[model samples]
Target: MSDTRATTQTVRYRERLWVPWWWTLPAAVLAALIALEVNQAVSALPNWVSFVVLFGVAGAVLSWFSKVELRVVARPGGGTELWIGGAHLPTSAIARTAEVPRTAKTAALGRQLDPAAYVVHRAWVGPMVLVVLDDPDDPTPYWLISTRHPDRVLAALQD
Candidate 1:
């Protein structure tokens, strides 16, 4: 006999939109080059100072470029939430959701896009999900979110 019960997992889906690993190579190299220039221009400063600047600039650049994350969570008590970057919305707020194929992305984001819509987009990630809001109190018409796996995102939200 099958034991029927609600899923115990709290996180339905999670993805980090990180910059490519090769990205760090160029960023670090540039930072190092800049630091070398600074060192040459200021010969009085300690050699270690240039290293510090290199690490600081590269760390900050990498961190800043790779922070967007999407997560779907099932609340401990009840309810579900979709988190895009830093913002979040309850699944109950979503009236409907649709996939925006790569071909139609330009149209969706162009003339048809609403000024008040909540959008978290990444250039590297193709395909997206449109979440139409039903909440009367909310002024935003909908949310356009970029996802590497739109199907997984849709499935997570549906569940």
Candidate 2:
């Protein structure tokens, strides 16, 4: 999706990362089971009411999970921006961009990461892009962003 904010600026790259189907399917199933258990525990409610509640809860959970998305947008005039859930980061303050291997990503997310760095991680996404912040005003040292296409993100950042 393109955003027409100004004439000079153009959105170069856009990526939206959502929870995969594998995760959503299992989450839905678990929600349904939990709803069933709750209905059994509260038997005073009518059967139809219980059924409706179960479906409603399960649907709501599924919708919430499905709607969770990590959006990355690169604008030429402005900078690269990452939107994960509700968090947003502008890459203009970024000093460097590095493509991290899967193993490196795993390690970085664990005990190897800087305490002050910001991380936008998704376990399912293997490759990641590390953006180091240069802005003196910002306290965050870097950002670890999970991306399927690291090369594209890197190129956009470099541009």
Candidate 3:
């Protein structure tokens, strides 16, 4: 038997671009129509209902700006990796891989010490697995990663 592993290519860095609010035009229209029809009923509904509706609207607006944009490139057999937005980092400096959960808190890479970060498509999108690095000489010590395919991305990086 022969070991036949495919040639390893550099994992391209991709910039996760935020989907503009305009992208939700259809959603807004739908909401508006529903709201118009439900306006009368809204008053009859419990106060909690209004709260939920408000949260829904706010969540939608936030989602519009939190979409992930990524930049990926061939690994080039070295530590250098460029983000889709043109940011670069060295894989050699990677401190560890932190598995992020899929939730609102995980969106936009929440504050440090936060185990999970939020992205635009928190529930719809795959959970992010951040590559924490030690930036001994810099203030930034971690990378916000929202790879399209987390398991595959992790596998490629491990290789």
Better TM-score candidate (1, 2): 1
Candidate 1 lDDT, 1-159, residue by residue in tens: 012322553879999887777877888788788888988899999978987878887988778877988989897678899987768899999999999988888898999999999988777778899999999999999999988889999999998
What local distance difference test score does each model get? Answer: 0.86, 0.72, 0.54
Model 3, 46-157: lDDT tens digits are 6556545855885677675565455444554554443433355556667777566566334545454444322223444556667777668656656655554666555545
Collision count of model 3: 28
lDDT-wise, the better of 1 and 2 is 1
Q: Sort all candidates by TM-score, best to worst.
A: 1, 2, 3
- Candidate 3 ranges beyond 4 A from true positions: 1-68, 75-77, 80-84, 103-126
Per-residue lDDT over 67-131 for candidate 2, one digit per residue giving the tens place of the 0 to 100 score: 54555565565566765667767877777889998978768888989999888776777898888
In model 1, where do residues sit more than 4 Å from their true spots? Answer: 1-9
Weakest 10 consecutive residues of candidate 2 by summed lDDT: 1-10
Q: What C-alpha lDDT does candidate 1 achieve relative to the native structure?
A: 0.86
